[model samples]
Every structure is written in C-alpha cells, then in structure tokens.
Target: MAHVRRDKKKLLTRIRRIAGQVAALERAMETEADCSDVLIQIAATKGAMHALMMEVLAGHLSEHVVAGKTERGRAEEARTIMELLAKYAR
Candidate 1:
C-alpha cells in the first residue's frame, strides 16, 4: 500500500478507472488486437496506478511523517518518506 491513504472518493475513482482499463485489456486480448495496442493500454493502466500511488504516498507523509513527527524526530521521518517518494517517482 506504499503508505499513502487517500480520501475515499479519490481512491474509488482511481480504482474504477483501473478496473475499466483491466477490462479493456482483457477485451483487446480476446479480440486479438495488435500487440502495440495492448501494450499501450497496459502502459496507460500503469500510469494511472502510479498517479494513485503518488496521491496516497503524499497523504501518508502528511498524516504520519509530518503531523506525527516530534521536534527531535522531524528530520528522520520526513527524510525517509522523501527518499521513498523519490525512489518511487523514478
């Protein structure tokens, strides 16, 4: 779950789109579409999933790494999450 928890509405919307993308991929396979077309859809789905992940990660950082930090521990958790987010973005 990559630590970010988004609002219900945003989560649901992203999930719905991912589900539709999955269905589309399946249908494309069933219809024997071009390999390129199927791959393109797969990439689109991946991009959507990544966007959702970023949203959730941001939320997690806000609530946990920032709000939960102490004066002495502030740098530690914030740095950890920033590193993780950078890695994920890459």
Candidate 2:
C-alpha cells in the first residue's frame, strides 16, 4: 500500500471532485433539469470513476500482480482484476 500512499493526494482529489459531481447530479434531479443534461453529467461521473479505477489497477499491476510469485497469488490477482472489469464493463 506504500505505492498507494504516493498517489493518495491525487486520488483523493479525484474522489472529492467526483463527490461534488454526484451532489450536483442529485441537485439537478431535484430541480428537474433537462434529461439530456443529467445524462451528460452521469457520463462525466462514470468517466471520472473509470479514470480512478485505472489508476488503482495500474498501481496493483506494478506493485503486486506482476511480481506475485505463487500460482495462487497470481490467480487471486487475476480474479480481482477480472471481477472489477466485469462489474464495470456491464
């Protein structure tokens, strides 16, 4: 997780921005903004999330996945990556 610590500040910044976007999206819904506009906001939020996911995945690949020695460890790493991909690839 030391690698994670290196990017912690940048990651938190992205997370906070995403939070703000979500709040704005909620407010837009409450105010009954145009449907198209809301959908655009949703797309932006999803994109931001994907960027964050990639950063995490990159860190994992470099710090653990590639260097994992045991078959079980590699399998676990692959499973984790696949699960996230499947969930997000919907």
Winning candidate number (lDDT):
2
Error of 1 at 25 (Å): 0.6
lDDT tens digits, residue span 26-82, model 1:
999999999999999999999998988888777776776677748556678788787
Count the clashes in each prediction.
1, 0
Model 2: how far is 68 from its true place, Å?
2.9
Positional deviation of residue 75's Cα in model 1 after best superposition, in angstroms: 8.2
Model 2 ranges with Cα > 4 A deviation:
69-72
Q: What are the TM-scores, per candidate, against the unseen true structure? A: 0.72, 0.86
The weakest ten consecutive residues by lDDT in model 1 span 1-10
Alpha-carbon lDDT, every model: 0.81, 0.89
In angstroms, the error of model 2 at 66 is 1.7
Put down candidate 2 lDDT per residue, 1-90, tens digits, no spaces.
667899999999999999999998999999999999999999999999889989988898877778888878888988988898899889
Residue runs of model 1 more than 4 Å from their true location after superposition: 1-6, 69-90
